[model samples]
Target: PFTLRDKGMKHMVGKNWRDLFDLVIVQAGKPNFFTDRRKPFRKLDEKGSLQWDKINQLEKGKIYKEGNLFDFLRLTGWRGSKVLYFGDHLYSDLADLMLRHGWRTGAIVPELETEIRIINTEQYMHSLTWQQALTGLLERMQMYQDAESKQVLLEWMKERQEIRSLTKNLFNPQFGSIFRTFHNPTYFSRRLVRFSDIYMASISCLLNYDVNFTFYPRRTPLQHEAPLWMDQLCTGCMKTPFLEEMVHIR
Candidate 1:
């Protein structure tokens, strides 16, 4: 049960938060909340008191505690896509409801704000741009057999590694980002997409969209399917210092 006591929510939607939802259940004990069916729902007093009675019918304006998903669905008749559950924790809050019960889940990843902010910076963009150029150069590394050419290729390899470490440290000093490991998506990121139907920096992002707004997933191409920039990127590699060094080797 999210109360509109959060100033962000208060400012975003000018209405009683309770009025926005058919029901609000707090201390849901999720994972277990979705799994176990024994714990009955209890009412919470307006003044933060707990009523231990095992009640059945749910009402608005009154907050409830405990409660399992089985009883919750049976009580509310809110099932499948009609129920969009927002949770900060991927596994504990969203996974079960999405995987087992078929409820649409929205993941709240606050760290996305910081990650995007870093990615938009000039330094990060420069490093990433150069890294792509270096990859194309590396593909030509095996062609040159001369000592000078081999030494230059080694230097490029070292520079690429340093750039990777620098960009990774820009996001986090130790673990880097939860969403990425170098150029690839991390395990956490894979699980995030699997569990959450939609995700954003904050739940308040919904304020920008209409109630009927539909979201579409981006269609990313597979490795065998050439990206539109592949030819241009490889052609751009000819302008790099490595290409000039290769010309000198000849």
Candidate 2:
């Protein structure tokens, strides 16, 4: 749940780092941390000093470094299937944790703010820019004016480019986001969909909702799954049933 993603990054808050967990492992070099033969746990001496000796077993509120996921679970008395890990990198954090460790995982993407704003403000702006012109073009196309249709189509493409650029610049003016490529998924996004079990804007995103809530994805019928010409289906509400696992923090 904590990491040193960058030098200045904050690792934890509102609690003593060592006191929060039965053990804390650092520099394990994940996703290798989960796969590699992990180094043993290091404990603090009675006088609040580092003890270089590595040992097995739980000494509550002690810190450790370079230990494997399975060993940590053994100390905590949980099997691999009972563990949950959260991370940010699509491949390094979420995918590798689930695939290698057999641990349930959550993805934390901090750039969702940019994507959300583009969906809201830029989408509205794009529609406003084209409404009158596209309406006129539709009328002209119906009249079979091939030459006018070609010119109007050019205008439509130009309008689309402007809005697309505007939104892309907000995330990365030079390269845009790894998750988006125009109207299609970027290559990173293609891989992301196959791996992540769940995703959110940030780690804090869950704090706003039921912590134990089990997420249920939309069960919409695809074109091939539904009767031809039905065109659409209601996927139903997003909430899960009887979320007894949900926790409330005071």
Candidate 3:
């Protein structure tokens, strides 16, 4: 899947951006993709074919590593913090980009829904357990009416109150609010569009603050306000196969 995606992306850009842009960096292999200076980027043909011979002789402006981000910024003459780096991973993309370069950073979590759903499921499980325990105790109290049993029931009631308190604590409003942000179909759909716009603008500003880059915004027109089946499946599939199969069989 990654190979196909990369191929599509490489095909789209081809050698065009190379000529149009002031500088073009290829095979970035980001987030430790370029950590080792020994690893060289093999120049690619227009069709994304590798030219290894040219790779070895590649020079500083052409291509080289031990190439720090600061050096790249200075060389590019990027004068301001207007440069924004967009990456999907929080730690690798935003964390490293912001920490190392202080560049404007936009982090994309493609599996936003799945991450939220996983959190919601965990909360639901806790809620279910507490409800079950409380109901069971209530049933037991009604079934037995002896003096000793009634005293036991009173203690159980106190325990039930504590359990309810614990449950409330377990399902905190702040945490629930975050989870609910994703679950609310209306809210997420609106936010997703806004997020894409914000990301693109941020990236554009970083590349060149005064210059305008082509902006192509498409919603892909979801059939329903909620995420479609494929989006959910694609996002959910990011989990380990064992975890996916566990849900699949049930």
- Please give the CA lDDT of all the candidate structures: 0.80, 0.59, 0.48
Q: In terms of TM-score, which candidate is stronger, 2 or 3?
A: 2
For residues 1-250, write the lDDT of model 1, one tens digit per residue: 4343435546876657668866767777777988899999999876557898778788977788888888888888989988888999998899888988899999999999999999999899788777766777877665998999899889979998999999899999998988999979999999999999899999788999998999987656565554465433432334445566444222
- Output the lDDT of residue 191, model 2: 69
Ten-residue region with minimum lDDT total, candidate 3: 234-243
Ranking of all candidate structures by their TM-score, best first: 1, 2, 3
Between candidates 1 and 2, the TM-score winner? 1
lDDT tens readout by residue for model 3, 1-250: 2244346655987734345444445646566652434454454444545566634333432433233354454346553357755665555555555555556556454445444454377555564344444445456446788899788778757865665554444435344332243224445445434333334322334555545654444445343444445523322223223223334322
Q: How well does candidate 2 match the true structure in TM-score terms?
A: 0.65
Enumerate residue pairs that collide in model 2: 212-246
Q: How does residue 98 of candidate 3 score in lDDT?
A: 59
Tens-place lDDT per residue, model 2, 170-204, is: 56778876688654679877766666767778877
Better of 1 and 3 by TM-score: 1
Each prediction's RMSD to truth: 4.9, 10.8, 15.7
Candidate with top TM-score is 1
